[model samples]
Target: MHFTAEQRLDGGVLERTFTLGEIPGILWTPASTSAPVPLILLGHPPLGLRTMYPRLVDRARRAAADGFAAATIELPGSGDRPRWAAAEQARADLRRAVAAGGPVDDHVVDALVLPLVEKSVPEWQAALDALLSLPEIGGPVGYSGGVISIGIRLAVVEPRISAAVLFAGSLVPAVLFEEARRVTVPLHVLLQWDDEGNDRRAALDLFDAFGSEEKTLHATMGGHTGVPQFAGESAARFLARHLK
Candidate 1:
């Protein structure tokens, strides 16, 4: 990661902007963190990181306050990375299906998700690589995001991420359910019961696929944007237990 800009936020959170070959990312560290702290990789909605800016900032800030270094990079097709010619088409297809109140087909799912998986997993790993090399970051990595599929992938393949907090609000492909079985790390999954556009069955199925003996499912009553503030506090406590 090549850092291009940086500034300190309120509460002594150091925010640094970097680019992994045009992929913009931010690294956040708390001022009180004098020693190496656990790292967290934050995943955002597919629309882009910008759409989730408020929650992202809140999450990052809360994590930093709890003495964890939180970070997030732009997802493929969302940031500085050039979009594939078919990217919009894939999105439109999924949108149409959702608008029709029908399930997105396997082909559409493959088109929409395969590219993200192919491109994003490596980028996140790269960000982890670069961040882990810093003296201020190390050990017991955690991941938090609503992009639950990506979290599942990372939990399966990235052994360094010791714990994760996943937001269950998407339709994951069946193959990913298989990959979910490979994840043995501790997980804390949050499911907003009435979240719009969320496939509750899929979320439950995906949660069931996690092989981790330590996985916990947090179900709350709310919509996508209606998640209660207390949920965040509970999640922070969970991360603190395992990460701090």
Candidate 2:
């Protein structure tokens, strides 16, 4: 992995854009730190990072100000990468099924999500390894994102991630709940209670399935993109508690 660009921000934070093979990402680090700092992995929503630029910047800046390093990588088929046709087809099919009020088949759900999990987990793990290898980063990492399933997979398999702040925005593919049962890290989940596209029942079920004894569900009223400012503050505190 190599940093392609670097800029020095106010208060000595280092802003960098880098790539590890096919994966492209941006990183924020506090400047002039003598020791390695905590790191938080950020996951983007379906709209991609460009559409959510403010949110990503806010979270990354907050993490950096809180003495943590934060980074966000482009998920499969996002960024400038050519979109994966199979995943795109599956998503289109699922949308049509949803619009028609028809039941989506289990196999179809698996097809839409499993390959993403298969590809994303290792990429995140690789990114983590590369990020941690840098002199400015250290242990007790955290994961934060609206990509709920990718968060679940990493929480279950990545031993380096000590905690996660998850946004429960999507209807989880059923099979992922089983994987949720294996997630042992502390979690702070944010749920917008009135989100139109979310399955409240499924989000609750997924939360209940978490294996971590110290997990929280912070539900507030809003749409999918309307998470309250206080909810973010609460998640930041959770990250500090476990990651600091």
Candidate 3:
């Protein structure tokens, strides 16, 4: 990992930008700590990291206040990374389907999300490998954020992840249901009840599919981006219980 920039935010939260090979990423931690802190991998939509920086840093600052470090990596085909033709095509197809006012085909959903899940999960694991190597970051990692499928896959396959907070606002391919059943880590899922972009039943079904014996769903009335601040505080509390 090559750190390109570093700054200390208010409240002693240290933010650093870095690159792991081609993947650009950001890490945030308390500037002064006597011992290593647990890490939270902040997952986000395919939107560029720059676009998501404000909210990402907010979560990081909260994690820092709660005595944890937070880090996030750019996803494949996102940010300043090279464009992916196949993913682009899949997105085009999805847009057309949504605009046509028809239920998105399973194949289309598969095309759009599965490959992302396949490609991004390993990248996240790699980031975890690098982030945990830092003396200030320790084990029992928690994952929190969107692109719920990626969170699901990582929870199932990444043993280092002890807990997760998932946002149920994305299309999930049917194939991932089986994978979801394999996820045994504790989970806290946020659902926007009135989200136009999400399938409420499908999100509920996905939550039901998770194999974790401990999982909580916090459903609130709002659009996709309208998650309340209190809801975020609740998620932080959940992560603190498991990761701290």
Candidate 4:
């Protein structure tokens, strides 16, 4: 029951690393553990920096206090890891689009985008599987991501997952939406009003494609980041309803 905290952004948030078997992840959790709890796995945007966002850490910490364990994961090649030019190109394209700019003209960006997407999915799936296997996590699983939202969708469709929460991301290659239609678990999607990459319409289309009997969609004012502000309460409700 011991932990360490790395203060960041003038103490607004702290990056907490937790040991999961041999694999360690930077996460935010409650200081005290009174019960076995559900978990929220945060899938981050494809940022080159490893610094954990203060708002995300705050949201995760709050979720843990509310009887859920929340953790944000740093994808491979992101944050404290060596960067690849290909990855950087892909990230730049996303940043440009977010600024209301046109698509990146770099061919390298286009070439690396889908490969990175595919690579990250399996890594996240393995991370979730390992987390669920832990004895301390007794409740269902949920996820939220900006650029990585589609990865969460791919992970949740697996039989092991009970429920999922997605933010500002979508299934890609267009065909995955068809696969999403077959998922039986309850899914809640949070959409942003002016999401540059995956806008509201895209979220609506995915929701319609889900075809889940228990799916729900909600909207918020802030763009991608706004969705996680509700991570504590909104996810709690979904996990309670579905995890049981």
Q: Ranking under lDDT, best-scoring first?
A: 3, 2, 1, 4
TM of each candidate vs. truth: 0.95, 0.94, 0.98, 0.73
Supply candidate 1's per-residue lDDT for 139: 70
Residue-level lDDT of model 2, residues 94-212, one tens digit each, is 88877887767666677777888889889999999999999889978999986788899888888998999998845567768788998988899999899876778878888899899
lDDT, candidates in the order shown: 0.84, 0.85, 0.92, 0.59
lDDT of predicted model 4: 0.59
lDDT of 3 by residue, 29-111 (tens): 98687899999999999999999999999999999998999999999999999999999999999999999988888899999
Residue 4: error of model 4 in Å? 8.2
- Candidate 1 lDDT over 121-170, as tens digits, reads 88889889989999889878998875777888888878888888988856
CA lDDT, candidate 2, residue 125: 96
* lDDT of candidate 4 over 29-79, digit per residue (tens): 445555666777776565532455665666565565566666655565676
Residue ranges of candidate 1 with Cα displaced over 4 Å: none
Clashes of each: 0, 0, 0, 1
- Model 2, residue 77: C-alpha shift (Å): 0.9
- Decide which is better by lDDT, 3 or 4: 3
- Please list all clashing residue pairs in model 2, or write none if there are none: none
